[model samples]
Target: MAVIATLADVRDTDPVDLTPLQSTVDPEELDSLVRVRNGANGDTHVTFTHEGHAITVHSYGMVAITPEHELTAEKYERGEGR
Candidate 1:
């Protein structure tokens, strides 16, 4: 099963800091492949991958390592991730 990890969860588990990766990517590009929401704490964000696309989720954020299988924007809108 695919797992979801929050920023806090990542910090607790991983020893290496991921500030560099977070700074490199555009937040808009990240949003293109996944949905990010402000966590309850308001300091961190929770990222959810596009369904069926098992993305490699790092500590800073989520990335679509593999190309997404053909799916229309309408289909994506029907579901949660867009």
Candidate 2:
């Protein structure tokens, strides 16, 4: 829900316009994994791309979404885009 809402907000479009997060990643598994990591006070993080955006969902309740261009820039900045 959060991921969809965020991606939609960032893209300035309705949630229905975006691909469902379930197609990219298993929500229930992700939640369970993050929940356990959070319970243990660990720094759990997961990153994936959806709808041309790079998304990082942190166990601490932070969701960072980077658009395709920014992601390309970041990868090139680190000399990995090529």
Candidate 3:
């Protein structure tokens, strides 16, 4: 069976948890590294790494994942129409 790990679980690992969001990247594609930082009022900075390339995303309360790119907090909030 596959194991699902959360940010809190990997906190002390070589890679740290900087966000509360989960990883959805395909393992077959590349090994991934992620970081998340809790921000003001549920805001957070989420970063993902594949190979040596990294992408940062800002999200509030929740995060949206996709195959191509991660969206920023501004974009996420806007999508919510809040």
Candidate 4:
């Protein structure tokens, strides 16, 4: 919800009319990942492009977004882009 809200704000649009977050990320997996990473004290985040921006959700309940860019080549080369 936070991610969606933030994206909507960044894009200056309504949340309900935006494409579903589930289209870009699995809600259950995201919740589980954040919970487990926080429990383990890991510096965890999940990043994906949504609504023309890069959305990164952190384990500390922070949502970050930026304009779309090519950000996966290096990570993919190192096999960590997933």
Give the lowest summed-lDDT range of ten residues in model 1.
1-10
The digit string of per-residue lDDT tens for model 3 on 1-82 reads 0111333232333234333223545433322222233454465445565322243444432332232333345566678534
Give the 10-residue window scoring lowest on summed lDDT in candidate 2: 32-41
Clashing residue pairs in candidate 2 (N, C-alpha, C atoms within 3 angstroms): none
Each candidate structure's TM-score, on Cα atoms with residue i matched to residue i, is 0.24, 0.82, 0.22, 0.73
lDDT of 3 at 34: 23
Clash number by candidate, in order: 0, 0, 4, 0
Which TM-score value belongs to model 3? 0.22
The lDDT values for all models are 0.40, 0.85, 0.36, 0.81
Off by over 4 Å in 1: 1-5, 13-21, 35-82
Tens-place lDDT per residue, model 4, 1-82, is 7888998998899999899999988988988776535455766888888877888888888888887654556567788876
In model 4, the Cα lDDT at residue 22 comes to 94
Q: In candidate 1, which residue pairs clash?
A: none
lDDT of 1 by residue, 1-82 (tens): 1132333243354423424334444556555444444464233333333333324643334433332443445467788455
RMSD after Cα superposition, model 1: 11.2
- Ranking of candidates on TM-score, top first: 2, 4, 1, 3
lDDT of 2 at 32: 71
Where's the lowest-lDDT run of ten residues in candidate 3? 1-10
- Pick the winner on TM-score between candidates 1 and 3: 1
